[model samples]
Target: MSTLPTSRPSTPFAVVDRDRLQANIDRVARLAADRGQALRPHAKTHKCPQIAALQLEAGASGLTVATLGEAEVFADAGCTDLLIAYPVWWDADRAGRVAQLAARVRLAVGVDSVEAVQHLASLLGTAPGRPLAAPISPPTLPELVVEVDCGHHRSGCAPQDAGAVARAGVEAGFVVRGVFAFPGHSYTPTGREEVAEQEARDLAVAADSLRGAGILEPWVSGGSTPTVEHEGHGFDEVRPGVYVMGDAQQWELGTCSPADIALTVHATVVSHAGGRLVLDAGSKALGADRAGWATGFGRLLDHPEARIELLSEHHAVAVMSEGTELPPLGTEVRVVPNHACNAVNLTDELWVEVDGRLVESWPVAARGLNA
Candidate 1:
C-alpha cells in the first residue's frame, strides 16, 4: 500500500507518492530498453521538471511536449533533447520562438502537410516566399517529423502520403527524421493489442515510403501508454506519458493496477448528507474530463466501490457501494482523476510524500503553457 502523510496539509491538494513515481518511471524505461527502443516520455502528463529529471535519470533518451511553450519550459530546465509532438499551425511570432528554442536544444517539430513544411522553411529563409506575411530569418530551423494517422483520425496524414510531406521537408532544407504515430484508438476496453499491431504496420509503411524518398532508414516512432506494451520493432522510440502517474482511466482500462497509481487529489469529506458523501475536491481540483466510457468523474483511492457521480466547482458527490458506510465529516480521502494530464495542469504544485511523511513540493512549472 502507498503511504499517506500523517498530517494532511489541506483539502483539494495534489500529492505524489515518491516510491510509486520512481517505480513507474523505471518500469517504462526498462520496457523500452528491452524492446531495443529509446524511451522519450511525454512531459505534458506531470508538467514538472522534477518528474522529467526522474524520467531522464531512468535512461529516457528525451522528452516530448505538446506545444512550443512546453518545449521552452523543459529546455530551460536543462533538457537537451525535445520533440513537439503537435502539428503546430505557425505564425511569425510562434516561428521566432521555435527557432530560438531550436538553437538552444536538439529540437524537432511535427509536420503532416507540405504547407506546414513550406511555412517553416519560408520563415527560416530556406524557401522562396513567406506565406504568412511577416518574415524574419532565424539562426536555425528545427528538424521535422512526419506524423502518420495509424488509426486515430486526428492530426496525421495517411501512411502512404507521408513521403510527399517528408520530401517537401527535405527540399525545404529541414532534415525529416522519420515518422511517428499515436495509437490513441487503443485507449479502449478491447482491441488495444490489435491497435498496437496496426500502429506498427502503419509506421512501417510510412517509414518505407520515407526510404523510397531517399531518406535512408528513417527513425520510426510509435506508442501511447495503452499500446507501449506491444513488443517488436515497429518503432525506434516510444512515447508514453501517463505511465508515470497512473490515473482512474488507466486503472479502469487495466493498463495499470490500483497499486501503480502515484498521484492523487487529497480532499476532505465536507458533508455526508442525503446518503451521498461530498468531497471538497471537485472540477476545479480534479479537472472536468470524463470520457464517454468513464465510470465517474474520478475514483476513490482507498474505496474501490465508491463512485464520484456528480461534480461541482468545489464539491465531488460520491455514491458509495451497498453496505459501505461513509466516513464522518472532516475525513480525508484521496481521489484519482480520470485524466492525470488535465488534473496536473489544473494545479500549481504537487506535494511530494515518501513513506507516509511529507517531503518536498514540486512546482508545476509548465502549467498553463498551452500555446
Candidate 2:
C-alpha cells in the first residue's frame, strides 16, 4: 500500500498569500461599511474555516452558504449566524435535518415555493424526538428569506411573485425576514452596470411587494463580486465571495486587477514543443469553467501575452506569442484559475505563504459537503 502525502509537496501547488487575503478582506469590509450595508461574505469561495474566521474578525456580519451541509460545517465550527442562500427543496427527511440544524445556530433558509415553505414550517413547528446535544430551550425556529430572480434567471421566484411567497411563508408559521438574489449576469463586463441596476430595481420591487403583504422586516440583499461595487443603497446586505481570492474571470471583468489576485496554481513547465509550453496543472487543478468570452483555459501570470490554447486533465498547452521567449523546462509559474470556488474545492488543503516562504496549511474541511 502507498501512503498519502501528509506534508506540503515539494512540487508546485496552489499558494495563498495571507497578507493579500487579509488586505482584500479589509478592503471589501470597508467598502460595505462605507455604504452602511451589512457584509455576510459567501464562504463557498474558500471553503476554509480560517478564511471565514478572518472575514468575521474583519467585521463581517455573518457567513452565507449554498448548502445545508455547508451550513452544518460552519455551525459546527462555532459560527452562530448562517444563511443558506440557495432556494432549497425540502421533504420529510431533509426538513428533519434542517430543523435539527436550526436548533444549533441562528439559521435562515431561502424559499421560492409555497410547498417548501409549508414543509419547513411543518418541520420547525414540531419538536425533536431526542436531544442531539446538551438540552436547551426549544429552537427558535429558522427564518425564511424569499429568493427573488434579480436577472440571474437561476433558482429564484419573480419579483412580482414576492408578495405571494411572503404571504405563504407568513401563513405557514415561518417568519418572512427578507429577499435575496444572485445577480450573476453582472459577471460580464458589458452586463455589469445594467445587471446591478436591475438587481436594485428588482430587490426594491420585491421588498415593496413584501411590505404590501404586511411584512415589515423585508431586508433586501443581492451581490456578486463584479456587481457588488454597484450595489444600490436599498439593499441591507451584500454577499461577495470571490473577492477574497480573485480568479481570471474577475480579472477580465476588471473587478480585480492582477495585483489583487491572491490565489494561483503553481505549476511547472514539463515540455516545450513548437512554440508551445506545456504545464503540469490542467483542468483537474485549475478547473474547466471557461466563460464563453474567456480567452483561454487559464492565464499564465509569468507570460501575460501567452494563451493557454488547450487543457487536458493533466496538462495545459500554452501558445507563446510571436517573438515571446518561453520559460525554461522545469520552471515553475503561477496560473490564475478560471473559477476560484471550483479550484479551491479541487484541493484537499491550501498552502499559505508570506514573503515567498511557506507559513501554514488550511484543510478544505467543507470541500465535498455539497448536499
Candidate 3:
C-alpha cells in the first residue's frame, strides 16, 4: 500500500491522492457514459469546487447537492446545472434564495408532498410581499423532481404516491422534471444489488405514474456508491458521491479496494502504551460514523491489520493484531475515515498529493452549507 507524505504540515489533516482521485472520477464517468446515463455526481461528499470541476470536466452532466446553500456555492463556482436532491421546505428566506438561483442556473429540487409543492408555488408568485415584475414565469420556476420511496422510507413518498406530487408541481406551473430516490438501504453487506433493482423498478413505476398524471418523458434518477455500477436500468441520470473518495465503510463493504481510496487523515502517533497506539486524530477529524457492521471507528491506510477501537475529540486509540509491531511515538500515519462525506465536512481544506508529494490545497468551499 502507498503511504502518505512524511513531512506534512501537522496531524489530522485530509490528504487526497490526486492520482487515485482522477482514476475514480474517470471510472465512474466512463461507466455512466457507457450506460447512456447522465452522471450528476452528488457534491455533498467532497464539497469542493476543484473536485466538482474535475467531475464536470470528466463528463458529469451536473451536480447533486443536499442543500440550497450547497447549490448556491456551486452556482457561484460556475456549475450551470444542479439539483438539490433533498425535499426542502421552502421557507421565506429559502424561497427567495431558490428563486434567485433558478433565475441563474438550471436548478431542480426534490419534492415529496403536495403541500410543499403548493407552498413553493405560493412563494414563487410574488417577491416577498409584493407582486412580481411580471406574474411567476413558469419558465423561471425551479424545475421539480418528485421524490419516491424505493424502500428506504427515509424522506420520499411511496412510489405509488409520486404522481400526486408531480401533478401538484405541474399545476403550480413548475416543470416537473422527473423522479428521484436514494436507496440508502443498499449500504448493507448484501443490499446493493437488491436495492439497485428496487430503485430502478420503483423509479420506473413512479415515472409511469407521472405519465398517467399527464407528465411526458419523466426523467428517472437513482444511485449510491454501492449501487451506481449495478446498471442504471432505464435511468436518465445517477448521483453517486462517495465513489470519489472511498471510505472505510466502502472498503469493508467490498465496494472499493484500499488502492482505490483517495482520501485519508494524516495523523501522528502521539503515544504507544500497553500494546496500543494513540493517534492525534479522533472523531473530530476522522468523523464518528461507524455502522453496526463497521469493524472500528476507522482504518489504518498502511496497516490493514490495525483497528481504530476508540475515538475522542482529539485522540484515537488503535489496536494492532497480535504479533504486529506498534509504531513508535510521533510516527505519522494515515487514517481512512469511516464516512468520507462527514470527514470532509469537518475540515476546511484538503491537501492534494500527487505521486506521494504535496501538490495543492483545495478549500472545502461548500462546507457548513447544510442548511
Each prediction's TM-score against the native?
A: 0.95, 0.93, 0.95
Which window of 10 residues has the lowest lDDT sum in candidate 1? Answer: 129-138
Candidate 1 per-residue lDDT over residues 258-348, each given as its tens digit: 8999999999999987889999999999999888889999999899889899998899999999878899899989999999999999988
Residue 129 CA displacement from its true place in model 3, Å: 16
Query: If candidate 3 were superposed on the true structure by all CA atoms, what would the RMSD be?
Result: 3.5
Candidate 1 Cα deviation (angstroms), residue 290: 1.3
User: Candidate 1 at residue 120, lDDT?
Assistant: 76
Ranking by lDDT: 3, 1, 2
Q: How far is candidate 1 from the true structure (C-alpha RMSD, Å)?
A: 3.0
Tell me the lDDT of candidate 1: 0.90
Worst 10-residue lDDT window for candidate 2 reads 127-136
